[model samples]
Target: MDCHNYITVFPERKRGQHLGREERGAIQQLNKQGYSLRAIAREINCSPSTIMYELRRGTPLRKSHRGRTPEYSAKRGLAVYEMNRMKCKRPHYITHCSDFVKWVVAQVRAKKWSLDACVGHARLHQLFADKEMVCTKTLYNEMAAGNLPLSLFELPEILKRKQNKKGTRKHKRLKGRSIDERPDIVDLRTEFGHWEADTVIGRKKGREAAVLTLIERVTNNYLAIRIPGKNSESVMAAMKELHAEYGERFSSVFKTITTDNGSEFEEFSKIEAWGSSVYYAHPYSSWERPVNERHNGFLRQYIPKGVSIEKYTYEDILHFADELNSRPRKRLAYQTPEELFDAFLDKLYIA
Candidate 1:
């Protein structure tokens, strides 16, 4: 009969689709029955050249009475196709950037650096060539795919948070001036001396150790001091030490400080008499001092919640604060807070 009859028996193959095992088997059976290459191509909805190539690849030497003869095997064609596909896959960047990947893992484990910070710091310093490093998104993807050594828990501030209802609650009493009275310059974060203050407590029990935290609005320079307890007396004592440390430059360095109406900061307004303005946020409003709250979260990475802060020495607390200050921030153009803060101090003293 006619070769066109075979086309009706087999379903038409889509253009550019690779030949499957079933199609290959059909090619062998048709070719055995003396079907022309062009006729077989029409049957499978492929080109004549594709049939010719498949025949060459699928045909192998077969032993017979008249020496070795070539015969097409569907199994042979599929094996060769799979081998070629494996060889044609795109190479992963991890192989070429092995050194950079290793360094990233080390920093995340040893220094507790965020993946984005690691990538940004490396790019800012030109620590590696363009071909030798992947983007931060790729790094996180590799971690998710289990290609990296680090785990999700090791990353700071990467956990999901429960959504809470947002509303402003009125406080029974105001400890000091309200944040409403704070100057607009403080909100803009363009000035250098405006700061946000807060306290991190270890446990809810009586007389637990706490940490006093302060962060500059502009440079995000962080200062953390371990104190005896979360009380106004302890908070003022830390402030006194800071005032003494800054000495003549205290007023200029700490122009304004915004804090919450916590009992720990009840006596904090006294700093105004020492030359700096103190503004108090509304009750249950932590967002008013976001920078300090965020840095306190970073501090939690080293000193976890519910654990006594007294377990860590004063030097350990200082080291944690220093590490935070030395970390590169994307908002700071990949520069460390310490670098920008020191530069600002230099300019202030020279003026």
Candidate 2:
């Protein structure tokens, strides 16, 4: 063949290819001109199913005319095709597991379990077959797709707070034993009695009731003691009451308590007389006592910010802690905080 006479022919569309915008527009135009689905497919050199899907997608959501049947618009077809294309990806395998979806929604709504806890607990207990449930990330993706009952906003706590851009020097008074001097065993988390303490304040103003929280480092066990106020007096009184209740076991139950330099916990070091060690985190270093800070943030889900803590009863505060303690933690090998805490107590009592 002479180079001058050579003709390079490109098929309108290759076999097993997706329909392009031009092809979709053409199908819509031909269909409006009264072309059959098969005729449109042949004219565009595509499959009948492609033409069928295009027309079906391009059809208006509502009725178009009073008497005449709605016709496909090329513009609408192209737009729809593009939108669908933007969403094009591998069909998530998790979406097909309706049973798993039901379980996830129930766990979140009734049990108030976090997404990771739900998946981790299910896998740990072998509650469902491997094919039935999805991993944590897949479960979240399903929620994002609106396949489950959860929305991003309905989640108890998900996003992290952004730090302020302005830098300022913070002066936090370390009134108790410094965390730097604490035993290495506490940081190792191999022992059970090590606790991180903090306060949860509502509305962040006035002399409102607050919750005194303690989290066991080993098992993520949580305790919330509602106090009349967040003063040194109230904080010390709560610890004394707990000490009286637990008696001799109080020392073993609370081996060491780590806390920030909040005014309320300034007197925490006074509890050192109970044979319990009290340590304070460095100034403005909330991360130094992460367990206490994170669990306190979780408490906000129930008592919420900008709301008065005075409204909730003492029992309500305990209930919130109980709910969290009963839930499984991924780091705990799916064991609940309550279960692990009780087991540790039993061991201590036996010892």
Candidate 3:
């Protein structure tokens, strides 16, 4: 509709009429010379931009005549209208359009290909080549409506790649109380001091016993710690130091702690003097305390499990925590978790 925005190239000709051979010859000659597009356009009495586009496309002779020209515009419109009218009278046989559906399904089955990916590929590479065609989303709607035999939910099977097996400590042996006892406010995250905790294991082959770990919840932000041991005393001592160093930060934001039933957290009451509540996760659902699990994974880069943390200084752990906090998180819309945690604090009623 916006003719001014686009440089209309060739005027529409009668449907069967091709470009004159002489016109094609001229394009071929000028292309061989490598004359400036503007100079060629002036020689041919056409727009320079048109010449440039044609050259970029290797100067193929134009054959199709579809859109408006001063003479045939009305005829083309009427022809399109008649075709659509006839098409509307026919019963839909969308299942016959298996090629299109197969293409969509193939893309969905590919690795890491989301709906967004499918939509983008269809628009950029398929539909937009003919500007009049429906968009990818429109195609999806029609496909869904048709209820073709293809299952949209089933993605193609990727080769099964083995991942490092995460170790699970026996929760039954963990000394901490069950998560059910945690206050309701902690669940809502409306108040601070409720934290989820976990540990990230080291590399494959059980190389080290170093623990990169932390305790944090909605209201409180915590720096990571490398504990020398996985015992209850080591965990309790690290938490005690965290509370002591960040007394105000802890008092305000640190209200409750939730952790998987790891025996490392057996001494749950070590920081009870800090007035923070604590609870334990159920069996096999450590994702319930996502923050701790997330931070634990991060610590794997530094003080991984099975490694000796005894060799690393407190400063080393502190710096690692700094880097971890600085790293961007997708959950925070590319904002660093450190920034999100701080912003969350400013919004909370700190004690």
Candidate 4:
């Protein structure tokens, strides 16, 4: 180690400790002896940058005394270290945004909104200035550090994330046409009217009510209609009602829809004659329709499994879908699904 750059010496270095007075003195001595920064660090079992920073931080000006040569002083280094020690404490500003925090907590608890959604939406709307609001990570860190009133588990998605289960690889029957034949434009989601459909059931044994959901691929517009049961008839009835509601515009609005191989959607392929196209996903492949599956997870926050959806009225289902559609999505550049969907409609009809 003392050979000092004449040879490269590899040694086990001290890790993650602050600079000490002894290290500073060693730096001064080695530097005075014409040793390079790397050589000094190798001899003292530390990093070259540590030596370089310490030299920069503590080296004093000697422009008058040495005509521009400034020497490293151990006494000066220790004094600088003491000065940096005083600045070690950073003020905790998590409490500064109390109002914003309350609004975020309320939205999470009442609306089942995600933290990132709440933060991003607020920022996009200018609800709070830079100093008045904390980032999503900072809010999570506040919960982690116990500086906040709530725990991470109190959030809707946090606990459910760990509980996500793999679906059965059971036989999934293919109906009508395959999604493989569907246009690539549906996947790109740039144009409107393409949708992914799914059925959410309640109380596997005794429940008769289910939610027939359709999310627009482009605008992320979510539609959840309460069906009579988890069967082909119920799904078909709901689709007919949706067809009747939009009338002439129905075909244009729902240009194409992608569905899973659930028994409930077995007769769903009948919509092919109704002008809008219907396509089926592959067996046991939920990833093929990612946006639909993700929104289903969000719906689980309201209509949890093993509970009866029969108890909730159709109006209640509409309200739940409305809330979800109104919430801003990060993928949509912080725009709400309802907003984007309406804009698309205006473009299609008015333009």
Candidate 5:
């Protein structure tokens, strides 16, 4: 047999693999056993230069009978390695965008803006430099990691929701025209003046006050009118007031109104006499009017469930509706509902 065939061969270490404590301990033991740097590198599966650098890092001078002797220690090597690791990490993005972070926190707490809304509005209007702002995903990640000052509970919409399976149910009654007869253009939200109507009640007991909400399909212009109670009479009274306010343009502005089978809108179909069409969603089917339902959920933030609506003044309710209308919706390309709605009205009146 050839002697060269009996020699042992060690594979080179892979790139980016760092030395562990066991490797450091092995190096210390090998050095003490009078092993050469190349022999230790072969044993540890690393480069000989790696061992030299580790020795320089782990070795310390000791005062002894021989005066100032250098000793290599695995413990010291690990300490230096950990310290460098702490220093080598990239700095957080928050450190560079303190002002933007402050503004975002303020908007969330004061204006109740969503994280995506803040990021979108800022980017659309060039409110901050590119480097000074982080993306919406990064903001959410930072919030999850507790780096942001805001809590997850404050953003109820962002939390994971459990989806209940939808089941088919027979309707006992439908008050007006079925949504089945509604035009496809209304569902597509391509036409202006189409609206979804609903009533938000407080304290389900007794005849307490309530709010009548109407949201336009195209512009998302939300209107909230306080009513004496959740009854057909009260709803019609509010409608009459709206007709008086809009006058001849009421029919053009409210071309269609879709609502649920709530008792408050039992006579809602009567509004069709005023030149607008009325349709009723299937019983137990709120999803058919999703936009109005979402806006009602947004309203719940200000007027919580089981709270008496009577406590809020008409002006206060109007203010809440204004806040919702003025918010920049991502679907609207960051333009506010009021802005788009006013532009549409201008064109209608101009014609």
Candidate 6:
């Protein structure tokens, strides 16, 4: 369904609201467009008083030449700078109560409380006051400054932020296909024939056998196939089964398949023979295959470590996959994979 966008004006009650410079510019444009004060108020969703004040004082007409000097040259800029400086000048209660600070840092490390939450909790218990409550940013700064030992905060696990490394060369030989070689259409998932694939292995062998996962990158709709083994034949069989059940609709959606450098995905040519392009991720680079890895995580909730995939009937696996596929995701704004899949089909028809 198609919908038109419209803006609604705010009520007159919010009297103390301030308009920024861009808003003042908009008021100037709408006023010159000959919109009535009430009409402009309704259009901007501000009160008539707001519009009147904005028209008279918020925005002054640009003069042909420079006129009277302003009384306040450094308005908000000076205020913000001074406020930050004042905050910096405040004494550290952390230094006085090093024990309490260490405890708070430990709580943060355990994810028991966010910095703001800890500060609020501390204030409630009289552990700290408004003056002593440290801001989240300030706490992070203090941690980075080495004034406090991060080890006390379990810094290795707690404060660690991992980002994908760049400028790294592929570990495997170039004889194997690379993700960069995949077509642009595959990246877009325009017709749905493109798939992002990943293999899920477990820490415990018997509890979780490897599973091959595929996700439609665009819609984030996904499917998982439990593979008894990590061999090329096993991988090929799973791909073939997925294709057989989904048929042409599956064929229509899965134009290309991309996987990581794991040897299990060595059956790329066989998969490509079924009319799909196959690409491989850089070795040790899971971030490039984020969507498929996410589905694997979901599967792990059911078949975690120490469980063998051989124990799960294909039916059991499919049922679990269906449950996952049917559940609504917040990234899709609570739309189920089924709904999004249907929407994609509708879009395909419209096109």
Q: Tens-digit lDDT track for model 4 on 65-174? A: 54658888989989988998898888677778988889998988878778889899999999998898899898877777888767676675766644354665546558
Provide the lowest-lDDT 10-residue window in model 1. 4-13
Score every model by TM-score.
Answer: 0.81, 0.73, 0.46, 0.76, 0.83, 0.49
Off by over 4 Å in 2: 1-89, 161-170
* Candidates 1 and 5 compared by TM-score, better number: 5
Measured on C-alpha atoms, candidate 5 has an lDDT of 0.89
Model 5 lDDT per residue over 130-184, tens place? 9999999999989988999998867867774756636545455888789999999
Q: Write the per-residue lDDT of candidate 1 for residues 1-351, one digit (tens) a residue.
A: 568645556566796899998899999899999999999998888999999999988887556668657788889988988899899987778778999989998888878889999999999999999999999888887777888877789885567574564686874588888899999989888989999999998877878788999999899999999998898999999999998998989999999999988889888888888899999988988877888988899888899889998898878889999999999899998899999999999998899
Per-residue lDDT of 58 in model 6: 34
Q: Residue 147, candidate 3: how far off, in angstroms?
A: 36
Q: Rate the local accuracy (lDDT) of all candidates.
A: 0.88, 0.84, 0.57, 0.86, 0.89, 0.65
Report each candidate's C-alpha RMSD, comma-separated, in the order given: 5.5, 9.7, 19.5, 7.2, 6.2, 19.8
**How displaced is residue 114 in candidate 3, in Å?**
17
What lDDT is reached at residue 82 by model 2? 80
Q: Write the per-residue lDDT of candidate 6 for residues 225-270, one digit (tens) a residue.
A: 7777776777888888877976765546677778887777776666
Model 2: per-residue Cα lDDT over 38-74, one tens digit each: 8988888878887788778878765644676667777
Error of 4 at 244 (Å): 0.7
Candidate 5: residue 338 lDDT (0-100):
96
Question: Alpha-carbon error at 247 in model 4, in Å?
Answer: 0.7
Residue 70 deviation, candidate 2, in Å?
36
